[model samples]
Target: MTDLVRARLRTTVLLIVAVLVETTLGSDLRIAGVAPDFMILVVICAGLTGGTLSGAFVGFWAGLLYDMFLTATPVGLSALTYCLIGAAIGALRTSVLQERKSLLPAAALIGTAAGVLLFVGAGDVLGQTQLLGAGRAWLIRVMIVESLWNAVLALPVGYVYAWVARGSAGAERVGSPVRRTSRSAVPTVK
Candidate 1:
């Protein structure tokens, strides 16, 4: 199989696994009434590994799938929020951010916090006022705790995402050295 197809298959499997874990064990893993958002973490990983288009694509699907299991908000809310966040992260990764050992955790920290705000803000704008019914204090708590949780989990998740995305174009740009064919290196005789 080609690398693109293989990478896509791996990513799809990873998303399903993330959803399952999030739905089944998420609550149990909560600290101070906040649970880790596996879906967003995966989106962040996708952005870090793949760049803008990849991030947005993965974010939309991941959010849509996550929406199916949600009852509190409209179907496309998560999709929009995640897609925007993923794309933003990807843009930053390509433009402003430098690759480093700490990149994953740092991105996860900031991305998750932004995601929480975006989700709540979007939801409220869409008439889902209950999102803020808990008030700013609760929202702040969720943002901080969830960001911390994602940061802690980022390394392992990022490694797995890198493995899954191996051989894809964006993965090459982010994680691996590009291989130059010998034919390209040989100078053509005039």
Candidate 2:
């Protein structure tokens, strides 16, 4: 199979597995009254590893899958939030962030925190007052705890995402190699 096809296939499998795991064991793996948002973590990892478009695509589908399980909120809320977060994270990685051992967890930490705020803010604006019914303090707590949880899980998920995204357009961009032309090939300025 072509590399692009293989990469896309792997991506499909990864998303399916992630959604299954998140839906099944995610709640059971709570810490400090907060469950790890594995779906969001996957989206963040995709962004950090695969670049902006990759992240946005993955985030949209993943968020849509997550939305299927939520009856309280409107259908597209999670999709919008995850899609934006993924795209933002990807853009940041492309423009400013460097490849490093700590990049995954750091992105997850910050992305999740921002994502929580965005989700709540957008939900409130969409007439989902229940998101803000608990007040700012509750929101803050959820943000801190969930961000931490996602950060803790980022490394493993990132590695998996990198493997799954192998050979895809964005996968090849991570830790992009700097092109170096030989000095001898340069024309002399006589």
Please give the range of 10 consecutive residues that has the lowest summed lDDT in model 1.
181-190
lDDT of 1 by residue, 62-180 (tens): 99999999998989999998999888887777677765667778889999999999999989988999999989999999999999999998777776777788767555333332232
| Tens digit per residue, CA lDDT, model 2, 16-40 | 8988998889989877777889999
Native-structure RMSD, model 1:
6.3
Mark the regions of model 1 whose C-alpha exceeds 4 Å error after superposition: 170-190
RMSD of 2: 6.8
| Candidate 2 lDDT (Cα, 0 to 1) | 0.79
Q: Count the backbone clashes (under 3 Å) in each candidate.
A: 0, 0
> Model 1 reaches what TM-score against the true structure?
0.89
Report the lDDT of model 2 for residue 110.
96
Pairs of residues at least 3 apart in sequence or in different chains that clash in candidate 2: none
